[model samples]
Target chain A: MREARDAMTKYGRKAHAITALVREAEVHRDVYVDPEIFELEMEHLFPNSWVYVGHASQLSKPGDFITANIGRQPVLASRHTDGSIHVFYNRCPHKGVKIASEPCGNTGKFFRCPYHAWSFKTDGSLLAIPLKKGYEGTGFGDTQANGGLSKVKNVVIYRDFIFARLNDNGVSFEDYFGESLSTIDNMADRSPEGKLAVMATPIRYMHTCNWKMLVENQTDTCHPMVAHESSAGTAVKVWKREQGDSTETPMAVQLYGPFMSPYEFYEQSGIRIWPNGHGHTGVANSIHSNYSDVTGYLDQMVAAYGETRAHEILGEVRHNTVYFPNIMVKGAVQILRNFIPIAVDKTLVESWVYRLVGAPDKLYERALMYNRFINAPTSIVGHDDMEMYERAQEGLKSNGNQWVNLRRLYESNEEQDVTAVINGTSERQMRNQFHAWAKFMTMDMDKHAEAAE
Target chain B: MITEKTITDLIYREADLLDTMQWQAWLDLFHPEARYWMPLEWQQQDPVLQPSLMYEDLLLLKVRVERLTGERTFSQKPKSRCHHLLQAPQIVACDTAAGVFKARTSYIYTETRGDMLERYSGWASHDFVEVGDALKIKLKRVDLVNFDAPFGNIQLFM
Candidate 1:
């Protein structure tokens, strides 16, 4: 188990030993702290899996582009003149400078490298070169092989949510996401027009911990009552003091009340885990279940999808659907959070709120309020969680414990199944995420195509 | 007439309340329908449609104050502390008929907890209403210079 970790061991063999860090119900601290393991994850895990890049709405107009990262590699997505979206390495082929320096903007007719001004079409094909006559005899050419932005291997737009995979070595998009794509679909279906538009900018928060901690915390339903007691618990006390006699719960209380919900509330909500590190923690109920109705929003949804379908869509309440390795979405609330790992101990979390097109503006306001209340840098609830993550990062350095436990409800986990249904507080989702992590990090790239199937 | 000194004094008092962690006393400075806004974008127009970093009415502000003072709030165990260094405030507008006045102050704020400290420079724009010789905050908008940068936990009000 330890042989492959030897300093002199070959790179390929070293990854095989990484699986040793993860066990049935325990994960070694090195998995979260080791620089070498972090490098391996960037190389093997991020490139092979379909990581979300941007929403199609962001690139609705031709020549519009946005810059993002796949692991450590900087990439950009742009809508071409032909109306097709393309994801490419943001690097200019000449002298390797970034083509787009801004967070997002329209590239006009084409992207021009700030250094030396080598231009490329929105499709990432090299269009023009400065002083072309000088390069006639040289190896430089207009073709992509000579000078062009390299394209990512795969790009999938499922219900206007754009996802890109850096390498072509792993599972097909369909095989990887499977039924988990429904979360995106569910979000779009909430809009009366069956469309969702992302706010132009996302509110980004930095976490001084491994990115996986945020992903795991999404489905870890037990923490809210305990960890958020200060924020939510205080809200409960204040509500009882101010509005105890009132029959109608105010919107603020309705939003903050669920954080103090008993463990049984989550258990009854149910947790479902799907293949490839995808899962959500709600079926019958969630924190989103009790939100006050926005007047006429339901009627618009009913007009779009008939009464029964509308009710079905509205009734589908999910709290945080983790799309393996990077993205998490709250379908019921129309918010998406992407976790970008900055280093072994630092991660950037971006929260984006979406507008349900055709729904009442009041509903969108509620979503915006929720984002500010829970995810903002100044958020009362978010600060507590940030403290916990930072503490975990510091505590992992202690020699007293080499393993972090995930044994809650482990005895009943349906280990052999592709999908598992269990109580909301189960650690099965974390286990599922780690299993997928091991598969992506350790398995041979050649075998991934078949392994996913 | 609301003199510049009178408005500046009131603004300074507000900052003093915040710096001393007088959570309840600071809460009393705001009118019933006051809004505390920290816009996420440059020249952000619609707080309802666009997402702001901090947008809270009096109720939300009360919740924040309660949480900050809560016994179980682990994040505040170390007690994040902040200091406001403000440039001389300028009274931008005075509408005597409406009993409303606007003041803008450029400030450099620093927050520290344990070993970590963060410095933020911004303009705090305040809308004040005179009520019975007392000025109450109708709105306090903070516009940080790096409003778009990814930020760590802003544990307390800026």
Candidate 2:
């Protein structure tokens, strides 16, 4: 803890200088490249802020658990026998050994540590420890206060999505999410049964770039044209040959193949930025209408939730919704990507696409197609983005320039609370993200100290 | 009765084709209407109701092969090298109507990129449809030992 504090203080000094000239909307190039800033981010930002752990659907039944990382800290998200969810340190209380080794499984009744046979309830209560008489008069006892699994300060489970905050006092999940909550709401509202389940194992990848790169790319409407040119070009040619010029390929394929074309077309689509750094960019209506697969899902949604409400939900064709910081909700494909920063230069990305309950097989297939063809590790499109991100990271590390520009549409647009509409090709999303990042990073360290006191 | 030697020989031939990257020849080993399925490991009550990691038809598989073999497939720039070791081959069932002999085999597929080695152990169940004198796979299902582990690019057919 002391080492973490010292590291935070050292990096905090650097941040002070960096933040002064960079502004809230502008980030220093070193933030993406510097190891010191990355360590500090792990200590300060990651631990204190609300980090998404996993989806509630992942641990749906009692005794079901998924082992995941909250920033750098290993957290076990378990569904208790009482039907409540608990997010705690994966380490056992007795010996600090990780209880659950597998990514996910059912523990049955209780979690028994393999090392010492120390058992704990799924909710992280100490159930039993081997050789109980050894600790009869000792400091350690089978009590919650004595030593249960060190629980996260707060765990918020909303609509099967689980978020945990290490810090006790802060904004409520709703307040913290603010405008971003609508992304989740929109995702759920699209489902015919008004519920969604993670139908498959998350497609995970490691990128040799800053985690911020992945988050920024999630909604960067401009880069698809230049960065993803090769893949998109191939997609277009294939679609042309397979479906011919007259027929339209599925939206998933089109999204992957003609991704570059969208960048060219997005300028006319009009990008809308919301306050709290959440926004969407793209023509909402025509994009959906273009895809025959989505029409059936949209019809089902309309039937379930009426025409007006369903139209409002389905009409919001957001290519990406920045749930601020790490989570990105791609509503069109019913996929969500959570960015986990490993180092300043290393990031682990988990891609999960949900199955809208009661939706047609075709609708699910559309999302599955996107998952397999576009975002999967072997994806032509993903490889392009991965290569670009790696190059960007390498370039930033060089002494070529101190500043990375987000000055694309700087003077063209005014910031609005609900929607800050910018040019489709603008870097406003990047600017908005950095602004939110700065706010979270520099937010009162003294307040944290007071809370500790 | 399908002899153990015959099944082993068939598996060895298939592995050799894959290891040599004879993709077209490998494709010929599958029946025209064969199904290659790698179902998603679900916690659900029924797998039929759930989505899969790969539920592919011949059209998709053809496209996948085309992309992998394409000149501009960036991920395939430095091609993946693989070694398949098949063990414990067993004839599970025989279908008289389809003239298909179903067999289960455990394999350890070791892939190498540069110096990095990744070994994946999985059990593969193949439904072999006897066509004339040749045996073609009517269905091939691979269930990886670590089916749920976070994986990197699986560009090649497993």
Candidate 3:
């Protein structure tokens, strides 16, 4: 596989261009606009790391499948007849066609390729191929490593969260996400059943900028007050009208009006950036901010785990956890947003809200309302951010500014290796991502060579 | 008998109110329980199970109207001007005794905001209720032609 060395050099050369500036807390616009760098990111970065595929609850039954993508590679998660979840490359080995084309559906016993008559099991092993009598002497009849469909190499499921890698020999999922699993744990532990159900329909929307723009914006505490002031301010006026001169601020105001918070507020909010490019904020704000506990729900939780444990579980208020390359978990709202890269200038973002099992009905309803009012494509808040993303992509095309700034808190917070609890307003999260970005993009090609041998 | 022309004329009045940016006047035309829905999926019957582009009741619509007319709604900074062109609506179903009817109308919504001009064309299904010689909107559901294929900045109603 390594005999033809031309493409590897191109990948190396394209990646080197971004690697030079990313170390200095600065990245050139070419990384966001260049086609070669996009391909290199797919080849070098995504395949070597654990990219989130789908949640286990998405594949509810045997033969149920949900399709996803890792970088440019199409993948699907399917439940086997034996009741285990597996991730595969989603292609027939013979014709290289997509086995299941829909976003999700049941394969009903086995997968039959629509183009050809090739058939495979739910786990992607070959079941049947037509006209076998003609190829007795030919090696085409032989069932190789992949019988009919090519199986994905590495799949790791951590408590219903499924992740897969297209290639091998890299950081495992557990090591890649060190202490960040606690965030996931805190989210799942909210349920008395100690799990979550994918309750809402997933929303897929296209962004007109590079995927990293959305990633960086996840923890960007500074841009909100400036970029979203228009929408948030409008929401506040409307809320005040509803209150009819009452001085009491509504919880709905905090829900939509937090975008008007100044830099000083975010600075005191306590942002924590973890290793492996995981970071989060909004811990200062609780989901249980304004409401008294619902009847019987708290007692049910207490009955399940006693009082202290229930309080601990309900007290977790994580805002956003961006897991390196693609996954962003908004724990407070129980929503997961994944960014899939299509090209250098385009991205597809899919978000799904999870319902904590055995939790209060109002709790799930609040999350649903938040999803509809904030994340939906036509949402008032999303209208602001989407416009900014499109404008940012358009502005980056200009040569006026070659380097995008990540210099916020750059000098004082120079300790790159250690996880630090910086101010919420710091750009440390963006820098932290680029730190992992540099690592993944410039991972030693010698490792690939070693694997080839 | 309530003719199709009567329903078509009523719809045209509603469109005129929207195009003229008379949102409050248009809001008054609907019943208190009227639902304005634009589904994300084609023929999505229930708004509870499926996500929607716009699913605003009277109170929610009032809040949105306030925002749209506010000073700092940046998405509306340049202001959106709408022009709705519709074919003659057909009365699909009717119950004369119950004062209820359903009309199917197709429209082209041309909107100009800032320097960009975008158009949204769709089939609109309206469930109307006649009350004391006046027709009030009970439910207005819009099924966009590009309901699946997405576009940018869906500002005005179709």
What is the lDDT of every predicted structure here? Answer: 0.86, 0.72, 0.78
Model 2 agreement with the true structure over A1-453: per-residue lDDT tens digits: 864665546455344643553553466786798777777677666665778888888888999999888778898999988889999988987667998988889999999989988888887878887787988787665555356788986888888889888877765777777766767887787788888887677766667789988888876767776766556665665656766465645554655554756655777676667665666666443243355544477678888989899878877766777776688887767888888888888888778889887887766667766775556555656776786787788787778667778887776444534556667778787777676666566564554553353
Top candidate (TM-score): 1
- Sorting all predicted structures by DockQ, with the top scorer first, yields 1, 3, 2
Query: Scored by Cα lDDT, where does model 1 land?
Result: 0.86
TM-score of chain B of 2: 0.85
> What tens digits encode model 1's per-residue C-alpha lDDT throughout B44-149?
9988788899888887788889888788899988888999999999889877786769999999999999999999999999999888877889999999999999
Instruction: State candidate 2's DockQ.
Output: 0.27
**lDDT by residue for model 1 (A1-453), tens:** 444354454333355467778898889888887777788889888987889898988988999999999998999999999999999998998778999988789989899998898899999988888787988867666455464889886999999989988887678999899988888888999998999997658888989999999999999999999999998888888878876469998777788889988999999898888898899888668999989888988888888899999998889989889999888999888999999999999999889999998888888888887887888788888998999999999999898999999999888545732776789888989998998888878654444432343
- Of the candidates shown, which would achieve the greatest DockQ relative to the real structure? 1
DockQ of candidate model 1: 0.82
lDDT by residue (tens digit), candidate 3, A1-453: 444553454444334555675756778777788777787789888987789988888888999999989998998889999998888887778767888888788989999888877888898888887786665777765656236567777898887888887777788777788888878888888788988888545766777789999899988988777777666766766676666768756444656776677788778776788887888886675323444455687788899999999888777777788888888987767888888899998888877888888887766766766776777666777877887887788898899888898888777538764677877878888988888887887674554553444
Per residue, candidate 2 scores C-alpha lDDT tens digits across B83-152 of: 8888867887665565758888899888876545778888888888777766788877877776665565
Native contacts recovered, each model? 0.85, 0.26, 0.34
Question: Could you list the chain B TM-scores for each candidate?
Answer: 0.96, 0.85, 0.93
DockQ head-to-head 2 vs 3, winner: 3
Error of 3 at B32 (Å): 4.0
Candidate 3's displacement at residue A438, Å, is 1.1
